[model samples]
Target: MLSLDYSKLLILAVVIAIVLFWPPKNKSFHRRGIDPGFLNLKVWPARIWFLLRGRNIVEQAYLQEKDAPYLLQSLNEDSLVLPPKYLPELRMLPGGKLSASEALVTSVLGQHSGVDVVLKDRQHYDIARVQLMRSLPTLVPILSAKVDSILSETLAACSTADFTHVKIKEIVSALVLRTTLLTFVGPELCENTELQWLVEEFTNIVRDMAIFLLFIPKFLRPVLWPVLPPTARMKRLHERVRRILFPKTEKNVKSSRDFPTVIDHFVATSEIVDEKEIVAKFLVLMAGALHTTKMSTSHAIIDLCASPECVDELRNEALAENLNDLPWHLDQVSCLKKLDSFLKESQRFNPPNYLSFDRIATSTFTLQDGTAIPKGTFISMAAGPMAMDPGYYEDAQTFSATRFCKTDESAVESGAEKSQWAHEFVSTESGNIHWGHGRFTCPGRWYASAVMKVVIAQILRKYEVKFPEGQRERLPNVYLDLIVEPNPKQVVRFRARE
Candidate 1:
């Protein structure tokens, strides 16, 4: 066993070295319109490689907006329009080139979903996202039950009595997938061993595939995909996922249950019908939703554990405001202003990915200072820069539980719209190239946030959490494509609210 383990470790090291030192084709790295910067992607290893070389890509055209001199030379024309103060200039989209999600989704998951890419276009995209958003409010009944069961199971799963030195990610993943899968695949199959294996494994596989896709050229992805042989794995996972989703679905009509799940809900509202395809698209959404939610939840908990003073503020607020009875509701959760701010701050500094969300210009555009960007240019806002820059955030680097306290209050007091933390953190009314801009923004954000904030609140309310004896340092951050994840796994212990 030791020999085998050593062999595996040696193999992994060799792979890492090759991937790192392998002569990267500058064409692959600089491939125009493929993906912005390698760092902006969700692929691991490669994204890590990008982060290791973060200095090179820090303000490169692919990841961040460059200054006026070198900006215009990078590519196409037409996107020259003054960016709104609140909006970062997306790379060279001429003033009016409207980018749609259609081509993009199909590029990512449409084929995987086996659904027609046309439906992914702007009109259908907006309709589907809004429908999902509408269905979001309906998830309370589901999420509330989910929160209680998962939290209890988590506390029970602790390693010790006084406190369990637990790796925050594993526990977070266990709870997050459980809650999210309950909604996406429904209750019966949610807990089934077959289904759980599929969802969990499918998530892992998809994450790996995302890295593979980043390096492979866009046009060649279709050809390269089949060779990777992930489909065999997908077949098993999709089969189980379909069985859990509903019978009317094209591939899974054999099951007789007529009840609705998020999968069924999507099928009912759209022209979509192929169950396998639905599973594929839904899987993509799950990765986006689950990974970030799990990571952020982990961050928030660890942040609470790491900062005793912040924890006390949260404890007092929870007691002063008694959040237990009102567990699942958004309004109830909204009352803990500092908790809300802390979550915001944690995400701001400890954003799930080191690189921010990115956008490829369909046409062309310009920045506030008249920096022209060409069409086909991939542009990402300086999210990490913007979020942590003292210029953008006061006391920028330290995770202040109250950094956004004033911003939150200002919005409410001034009768300003309650923008999302992603919106507020990125400092925009417009959607981010990362989370999405305007119409393309992530709809599941509210649901993801609901899960995150509640998890943090519950932990703070119920346990005195801290790092296990000697390990107080928050784990270093990792980057996959553009997403931020914790430094692998770090443990924490929880004791009764003493």
Candidate 2:
């Protein structure tokens, strides 16, 4: 294993060397006027250090956005960071002209796994955009039930008033994956510990490996990937995933059982249902779906804990609705306006990234501001900072748990018209691109919103969550280039409410 890892490292180093030496195409745009953040790295050591410090470099760009877009040099690519005013233009560009998936694929070595191409394909996204969105109302019942059961099991493990300290991310990750699988894959894997383990392990590998693999060139990924440790483990998990899911899919096809899950929808929609395809797609879907909800829930929990008053508001709202007796319906979850506002407020402060709507220019494209981007230039909008800008939001830097709540006080304070988007987690007005921008915003956001609400509501109803003594403030998030993840070490005290 040591020998194999060293060989993989050697190959990776060689690929990096080759890529670095190669003359990059499309380095300049004729109409470009914006200043580059860090240019002309005359020394190789500075370039290497810059790569290590890429996230800070990009944050600096966000801090220094003047009147135009700014360029930031990443490990292997140069990205142009635009303000939110350019989002409408980005949304208008066709995929052929500026492809978000392609930019992501290139940045993360997605082409090697073939996951990026699958995601980019319109047919695959249609399943998410059309079927998943359409079925969310019906599926929320199952999702809510799953959330309730998972919370019961998790809380039962910590049934004490002495405050069982737990990492919110770990708990959220486990719960979100189980609930999502229950809705997407089926009960078979959701209940099976081995299958759940497989999903968790595979996703963890993808998340860790994708970042490291991004530094390696695409041409060499296939060559070096198999030699890496995670690659072998991922392949083993893939086969096991196939073994478990394929049989069920075939059985469903043979028996013609009508199930309310994504698998059933895929099987019904496809002319020739392929088990491998279905399994692969399901894994990919979980990778995207699970972490997003987990992070969102974790951040929201942190915010609620910081301001215990929000938790009181949510718990009261849930109690008024008789949450425990009522079935967790879409409308019921939607009615948790304070909870909705809390989630949205948390997202505004802690988004996936400072950037959103990432795209690679396919051809020379000019913005409304008359700046031209050359073909092959990577681009994105400053979504996170823009959302937190005081110009767009009053007291933007402060975390207001009930900022979006439709209470008379909040409405009067924030202005009824301005805080309208804060009522729904899916609402994306006032430069809030947590769901991205335009026609290609997250297709499953409605479903995602409902699932998160149910999980959070359950916690609020039964558990009193707070940070350890003197740790009321949230731990700062770890920023890695374009990614912002919740602090893994942050702990929360959970106890059954009296």
Candidate 3:
């Protein structure tokens, strides 16, 4: 009976796949005035094969195009690949017309929870942008102290004289998540180990579930999602968070004093705040925050470990800042040019994703050069390939820790500030779309930058880090679909800096 049921479901899935991707007879690529490479029978199968072979389509686009648009297969439909030239016009379009959030929903089978908070709830994002991101300089003192304290506790288990093997992902994830919650949720939940662990578990549950579901088509998600392991874990985690956070949220809702976190700001702005829903929203925020920052921090550590000279240079720069007397804000963080450059170099070689500036056309729209896009078509800008392009940077393939920080003699003669390159970490200038482009860029990136630097600085100041026994080379990151992650099991040895 079980075998029979499995056979039936397999047949149903095959049928759905055929029906969903069935080529239309009348409206072919040529008839629609689009590139035929997208629909070519040979290309179609090869692109599908690329999915299994770990070949990324964005790299394909960057290598082929000069300044023209191309075609690629998206999760749900055919995507139009645009060059950087189209960014200004496409970014200027209203979200209702060219919607990235809707594209994300389609990409992830509508499983990206709290996407609405990011797209529809302007109030929530505005408060975050103004109160958290832009206010980073002011919040740095409080955030830095929390970060320093957490580092001590997290690394205390390790002995100082001998190298203690530690999984960089687990250690950095805990540190980033805790400090983020500290700054975003306040001391109550941040200090609570159980609550912090719950957030981390929830993040893992949702991330694993989302990545798994990204492979499932939109039509089949409802039927298949319930059976996935992460689904059950996500539900239990959500309930646990709700039970823990409800009373705290209630107290804040009724409180008179203004709090420093984004949650306090959100509660103040919202008209009828449901505690359960708010908890879920916070989960979304943390999930989004934890994964990207954690991975970036891990990658930076990996790079630093691989090159001890880079570590010494960054540490020397950090020590020269005399950060104790300064306010330890954006301006203060900005002075650590080598640290900033090292992080950017790591990001350049291993970005968070292969694609960026993804959007779905809500209505039939034409590009500046008159290429028409159907209402339902998806589009994305190449991020990873653009960063790796030799046209953009000298020796693009090699890792240079001060690639961005190093200034030429011409700059000195021209009176350009050497510190200008620090913005590369967060800004989207010269086709650097990691943070994204225009108004749709990650609003919380400034805060994320500050948090990352603080944690890295604290680690450098207190402890020494290096790759574990016989593992001199940094572990290669894995690319699944569009997500990039550092090696989870790769251990780093840490000891107290003498």
Please rank every candidate by TM-score, starting with the best.
Answer: 2, 3, 1
In Å, residue 362's CA in model 1 sits off its true spot by 2.2
For this target, which candidate reaches the highest lDDT against the unseen true structure? 2
* CA lDDT scores, all candidates in order: 0.57, 0.71, 0.70
* Model 2, span 1-498: residue lDDT tens: 999999999998987666566444344431122222223322344345554765565556566653457665554455677766666667767777887667766666665553564653565567778898887777777777777777777767676648888888778977888888777767665787888888777667766677567555556777887777767776778889888776544354323223467877777787877777777777777777877888888888888888886677788998876545565777777788878888888998889876777788889877776777888878877777777776666677788877666445433224223445557888776457778767658877887898888888878887888899888588989876557788889999888776
Candidates 2 and 3 compared: the better one by lDDT is 2
Which regions of candidate 3 deviate over 4 angstroms?
Answer: 1-50, 54-56, 66-68, 74-77, 111-119, 157-160, 204-236, 248-259, 323-327, 409-424
lDDT of 3 by residue, 1-498 (tens): 999999999999987776557664324232112222423433445435546542344665467663667655543356666777777777677776787667765665445443344455666557656777756766777777777676667778767678777888778877787778876777776777888888877756655777787566556877888888877776777788777766544464324212467777777777897776677677767776877898899998888888887777788777777545333556777777778777888888888987777788889877677777788778777788777877666767889887776566431212222355533577555446787777678778877888888778777766788988788898878877666788887888888876
> Which lDDT tens digits does candidate 1 get at residues 129-248?
665556555565467667777777777754335676677777888788887877666666667776666666776665556556656665787887776656566666777777666454
RMSD of each: 10.3, 7.1, 6.4
Best by TM-score: 2
Model 2: residues with Cα > 4 Å off, grouped in runs: 1-52, 157-161, 207-231, 248-259, 406-422
Q: How many pairs of residues collide in each model?
A: 25, 0, 0
Per-model TM values vs. the true structure: 0.72, 0.83, 0.81
Better of 2 and 3 by TM-score: 2
In candidate 1, what residue range of length 10 has the lowest lDDT sum?
Answer: 70-79
